[model samples]
Target: MLLRRRRFPILQHLGVFSNPRSFLLHPLHSPQYSSSKRNREQLLNSMRDLKTVDAALDFFNKMVAMNPFPSVKDFNCLCSIVVKMKHYTTAISLIKRMHSLGVKIDSWTLNIVVNCLCRLKRTVFGLSILGLMFKIGLEPTVVTINTIVNGLCVEGNVEQALGLAERIENMGYESDSYTHGAIINGLCKVGDTSVAIGYLRKVEKRGCKLNVVAYSAIMDGLCKDGLVPEALGLWSEMTGKGIQPTLVTYNCLIKGLCDFGRWQDAAILLGMMMKKGIMPDVQTFSAIVDNFCKEGMITRAESVIGFMVRMGVEPNDFTYNAMINAHCLQNQMKEAMDVLDMMVRKGCLPCTVTYTSLIHGWCKIKNMNKAMSLLCEMINKGLSPNICTWNALIGGLCKVWKPLAAKELIFTMQKHGQLPNLRTYAIILDGLFKCNFYSEAISLFRALEQMNLDRHILIYSIVLDGMCSFGKLNDARELFSCLPAKGLKINVYTYTIMIKGLCKEGLLDDAEDLLMNMEENGCPPNACTYNVLVQGLLRIYDILRSAKYLQLMKGKGFSADATTTELLISSFSGIKGENAFQEFLQKLVGV
Candidate 1:
């Protein structure tokens, strides 16, 4: 068998008696050649027209059962088509059938098996196949190694991939651009942009060409990390190297700039892309529109939409959502509704976010009917409300002083497999306190405390504010002290609320102490904190102490609030005959 194989190496490689050279040679040289050519062409055309796995399998069965058998190339062509169809296991099965038929395997044929294995995320089996290649005396090609490297990268095994590349190099198989690109992209995806950049430098030193795909991958990673300046610098370097930036490259930079609120810079870059004949796509325009709407630059957002339309780039759902969200945020429901109508007329269907934004807006304006109408519309259109949607409606119900209705909403949420998050609880508690339902708020808080749910500080803050607002001073103080033991970090809001509570009960000294303790505890008082303390002291007619804190507040650049000013004006009204006192009161009010 060895002598015969050695004597007819091409025949062994082909696994058939038909010489591959016959197809390459002139058809006129043999009468049989043109007919063989016709069969080969017809087979290839049949493979090209294969649309389903069953059709491909039928083709494979026919090819393997041919009298002399088709060439290994034809079998490989069939295997590749199956692989493209994502029938990895079926491709492997077909290749296994080839081996069983004693069809001598070539390297390309083996590579297909390895490719299918890797596609299945079984890179370990692919490696075993690689071992089989060496055992069978077949030299694995660059394409084979590149496929494995990409497979490892996809599986987030970057280190192992690098090691494999080194191993291949030692075997006299140098890594190509595809190999380097895969590793660089892998590093970036794993958030090792700095490491990926280092690898890029190594590629430069080794004279391995790094293409725009690799550059774009690293640039995208940098932009996502908010390293926009570094990304832009790299962009300059890539452009300076005469590697023209692709649309993806521009989109990454544009999105990053917009994310960081560099709107003007983003606009300039968009313009630069246009001048360079790289037209901004829908994504590029959408990013600008979304960010502009978020920053409340409605006119600029509108202008971008106009330009996008003029350039014949139709606005997608996100583009319309940005417009709707902007108007919704500003409580301009009529204008938002108008945008919604325009979206519908233009054949751009409104999505869940569109209705959610409108619902949240109407809720903000306390227009529950409008909000509920949109919710019904959203459901009628077969769109399921996400958690944010439920949260918005629950908050809206609570905002309109309807705590019972909000609880009913929560039940409906549960029916839809949605659970109330901590934010939802906080909203309900705040609403209860606002509506003077203190006992009910207490009952809910007590019930939640016994549950295993990880409690959030916001909920505690609402409860604390409730206790303070409704005159539960001693109980609020006890809970405030226990919060530290409960592992809750008392933020400035909690401290300010406590200070106000203490001052409300004529505990001016303790409120002052909390104000001092707040600074000592590293939760420094904001303007609201200072104002709360001052207003509390002024409420108890402690002019001397209040005036001293006013001086301190002024030194810290904290201005008196309107409530504090009103108190100061009222306290000094009877003594207006004294010009010095009047001037001091005016100065305090201004401060």
Candidate 2:
């Protein structure tokens, strides 16, 4: 009965809250151990220097065999070191063995178990273990509870994390920097930057020195929300408080500045980060290059690529993709292909995005042969064609006046399990319209509506524009009237299209009414809207109303586009005020 009572009794205690960890290895039957204090010191130092999970396990097994077994602190220290290696599972395995051997476990040991469970994304089980700690006579500490809080934040259950933090604080426990950082980061991650900034201020007022993690996180949130200036303000405040910015801090601020086309500021920040010895990594340069590409500053992107080479920072896949995509967008296929070759030569494997961009570039120039060849090459290289890849080719086929070919590509992609998204349908609808398959386009759109797919406003615009340009004014008007019934908010573009259709049919009065109605209903006319209306009037030789709209365009600080200006100049034969057009041109060009 005594022997039965002592058979690994801690198993029952751990089993209630432990994971089903398959760590059932038995300790050696006659393991030897030295009583020499020097031997134990060697074990401790060796454990500290351990690098791999396998070696760490061997040390744990050896430690359990020591004559005067290492203290719980020694075992706890081994677990801590293993945790640093990010081998949470191995740490759990070690803990399981310790319990089976009846090594008196402490709160520190339970804290590790909680951390491992949480790191593995099992916060519920971690929370349960916290409860188990008390039942097994081990008091939970602030660190143990904070691990759960951080886990909750990581899993995006931020509201509950904040509530738990407050509950713990109210229970007379002083939360540390980790606790405060977790809550602040959670707020930022959930895109509640307003609440995050407020919480930051609240924490500062209470004398909690916000660390670099908290500042970087909130700065990231602010930057993502397009509040770059506000994030810069926080940056100044962070530096003013003598909190040294980390690589993450610099990366966030630099990326934010670059995104807003603030190149000079980004350059200055890059210099500052270098001066601080916090060298920007591959990600930082990639982001800067990406932003430069996005803003159509390909020359700047090329220059940055050169600078990256000079700084011994080899551009990664993102860097290559950005440059490739920028050249592709500008239809500079040679430059784009050159970058791809360089990427391959440098052993930087091109991803699906890489081929997709090249395919799109070739498509833009109506070179379906080159685009199709590249698609085959991409497949032969073991890269599967994504939806964007097919869309690029489909759009290319459409550009070549082959709507039927585009539709066939759509069916081919479906066979490959690459389902068509809304964008796919949008491209097809646009192609059909461009290729003069008006009835076919209408049928496809009707099918989409019948299927209850979320047909977006852009899709409707394509259909409306196609109807108007096809001289189906009555069909266009009926469809325009049905937009409001369909719960689509008529945007400025849609309103402009209707105005254009009305003017194309010589319905000058109705066109003028819709243009005036745009602002009354809170949708103001942009430069394009006014220009479209003017061009419509000029098409029918309505010089007087054209003059009125040109004056309105000037008043709204909108200039006439080249087409509108060309039409106005061409129609000046019926009017005596040719100087007025010249004068408007001068002011429009800031002369």
Candidate 3:
């Protein structure tokens, strides 16, 4: 049998008895050069040229059935092509098939497997494949190391990734720009830009020229951490070193500028980017539009949308949401709804943010009917209301004097797997207090207290104000006194509320003492506090004390409120002509 195999090579046994030169030169000439090898080559070429997943799969199935299987290189090539088509799971299966066919998996093949696993977010499995490479004695190249680091970073194991990068470099594997880039990127993602910049300098010291991706990573981290000036300085430094900023660099800077309300600088940067032939993407436009919306610059936001469309960049859901939110901020619900309609007509579905902004707008105007209608529409569309959406709806109901309905909605939300957060509770308590449902608010507060939910200063203030509103001055005083012991710093609002409550009870001395104490504690009262006090004094007809507060308010640049102004006018109008009241009016005018 051995002598026969030597006499006729393996190809001849497979009925490929053709001249080798004819097979190599005119491989498709069937009468002269048809062979299994040519058939496999044609199949490999077909696999490479495949544009769709189904075609790649069909060719892959055919390639696996050959008697003398294809070379490992050919198999790896097919697997790579499949992976590039984003058929990652299929690529993994193909790798397994190669292993099953007793085809050896070299480092390159295993690297492809690692990449596919990482793409699937199975970085742990990718690590196992790296271990397999070690077990098979296949030396890992820089690509393998970088792939592992990237996988670790994607899985948010930045610390482990850094350690691996260090180990590989210490093992004399000579970390490349890609390896250090992965580590730097991981550091930046975890908000360790300070350390990431250190590593960046280390990479430069390693004799590897840092690339745009590495620089962009650090800039992005700095920007996200609200260090826009530092990020911009770094940009200047990068450009000074002849490193031209890419689209990513410009986008990061633009976002950073917008975050800090540096709109003028952002526009300048946008102009510079366009001048450099780098087009702004949806993210860039979205950031600008969102910032404008937040600033209540709806017209400017619309102009940006027009510019985006003119630039051939179609607005996405986020773009529409920004516009919707802008109109909502200005209480322009009709225009907001019109934008929503336009977005839907363009096949862009309104997301949670879109609905939330609209609901909040209607709630702002106490239009619970419209809010509820929109809420129902959202649910009918199978979009579940999130905590923010619930908060807006509940707050709206409360604003419309429907605390009972708002409470019911809260329970309904919990039943539907949306837990009420502290903000939700705060909204409900304020609503109940304002609507005179004190008993219900107290019950809810006790329930939350029993559950050990954190009571922030705002919640405490709300409860205190509620007690004072209902003539429970003792309870309000008790809570107010316990604020410091509860580890809550008495903010200006808190002090102001306590002062207002005391004044309401006609405890002017106590109110005056608290005001003095707040000033002593450096929690100086604001204009609202002074206004409240001035109004309170005027209500009691303490003209001299009221004038003292009014003068103080004026000295501090606060105008007397409408009620105070009306009372002053009435009090002066009733006085005899050219009397003491006329002199007081002249004094007040000079003030």
Candidate 4:
């Protein structure tokens, strides 16, 4: 029904298509135009042959000036072409012109208007158009409901979309696959993967054979939720139902496995995909390489890159960034720079992430000059230094015992339009703390409180640990007490830091009290907490209490860490109670 006519011999007979543009610009002035059926048919055919917006507009303008208006289908066809050209606003305006011309509007015409409104994120206007369709005695179709549901999903109103779908079902309208897919995708977007799976199962039970798109949405949600095993279950179910897994499905599962560090399983999945004739894409290779880089398997990551090249999938920025970051993690600055040079030689322009990784690497080795050089190079290349780049520089300067210089870099970053983010603040505060600039750290921390950022538990823990290190027990305690009032939950790290501080000051009783009541306050101690407590008790020569904590630590499946073991062995060796300590050591070491 949409313009399939190829022959234009009739156009020559009508003298239209030869100079179609001129014919469109000038209207036919025949007095008998309203009665000429053949003339109207020729005009409609010519409008369909129009390939450009300019010519289409001319045709439309000339048609509007005619004594008898063009047929609605002819107008609809022109509007459809405009919408396809992505001039959705123009299509809506043309619809208004049709109404002004007293052309009877149909459901198809209104559907186009609803679709455009939805695309523009004006779902409320789309609903009004749906209402107009109903007022004109037109029942909404599946396509109409699907468009509205998708619009609601895009606007993050999944709950309302679900209610709409339910209402449509109650009105005896069977929801189609697209409608269900939209709802499932919305649930996934809102992190309600469990609810999404429920909807999926309900659809399956109702004999609605869902496709790979529906399964893929739920699997992606499950993967993101870190429920990879459950995602695998869905994959198995999909295959059992004769719904073959798509590339997206396999990628989701592979990424989920890689995230969990199940490298063997990921490799097996890759092989399975290849065996099934699903060619590995650039994203597939990037995910593999990135995960291997994270696990410090640099050789394997490089091999994946080589294989990607052989397979005709060119390595991208993500591929090189992963490879560069792997080298940087070990402070192998030369190797990282070589990767950067290789990337440049291959015509792949290095991005912020590429330079940031090298900057972080140089910073790890306390080489601020190299880091600053890369920063300048990136800027010279028209790339702005992101917050990570600044954080790496500041943290690196601090690590090399230049906290004051690191502090200055923070101000410089602000001057360059890079606001100090939460990590930036943490890096600077940590540097100040480690360099024994306690007062400066405290001052900056108080300044952080006035800012609009959420003072996360890690931020609180960092300052608390700093105060504890400087023997400011009272200051640490005051900060600790204010956590609940600030709507911050005290985590295990916070509890452990406070406990260590109390023990360091020889306040063993207070430390023990805090340790015992940690779970009551919803901050249960971890293995690190118990190890610190054991070391603390031993420092005070409380042999009996130290042995008790050691036994408790063992019962919790936590071995005394090397530091604790060495502390006990060195402090008690050749001492008066050496035999009793030796007996405790036997229990700890299973000797």
Badly placed stretches (over 4 Å) of model 1 are 1-36, 45-62, 82-105, 113-138, 155-172, 198-207, 240-242, 341-350, 369-384, 565-575, 581-591
Ranking 1 against 3 by TM-score, winner: 3
What are the Cα lDDT values of the candidates? 0.83, 0.84, 0.81, 0.83
The segments of candidate 2 whose C-alpha lies over 4 angstroms from its true place after superposition are 1-45, 63-70, 275-278, 372-387, 411-419, 573-591
- TM-scores for all candidates: the values are 0.83, 0.88, 0.88, 0.79
Model 3, range 205-230, lDDT digits (tens) per residue?
76788778889999999999999989
Report the C-alpha displacement of residue 568, candidate 1, in angstroms.
4.5
Clashing pairs in 2: none
Clash numbers, per candidate: 0, 0, 0, 0
- Cα lDDT for residue 446, candidate 1: 90
lDDT of 2 by residue, 1-591 (tens): 322234334434444444343433544565656768887787688777888877777787688779878998999999998888887766776777776676777789889988987998878777777766756666789899889999999999889888888887886878888888998898898999889889888988899887899999999999999999999999899999899899999888888888888878998999989997888888789889998998889998889889888989999999999999999999999999999999999999999999999999999999999999999998898889998899889889999999888888888898778998888888889999989998999999999899876457888888889999899989988988888788888899989888888888889889989988998989999999999888888888776777788778888889888898777666655555677765654565333
Instruction: After superposing candidate 3 on the true structure, give the runs of residues whose Cα lies further than 4 Å from its correct spot.
Output: 1-34, 205-207, 541-591
Q: Indicate the residue-level lDDT of 212 in model 2.
A: 92
lDDT of 1 by residue, 419-461 (tens): 8888778778888888888899898889889894436778888
Error of 4 at 391 (Å): 3.9
RMSD of 1: 7.1
Which residue pairs overlap in candidate 3's backbone? none
TM-score of candidate 3 versus the correct structure, residues matched by position: 0.88
Please say which candidate is ahead in lDDT: 2 or 4: 2
Model 4 C-alpha lDDT per residue in residues 267-354, reported as the tens digit of each score: 9999999999999998888889999999999999999999999999998888899999999998788899899899999899999999
In what order do the candidates fall by lDDT, top score first?
2, 1, 4, 3
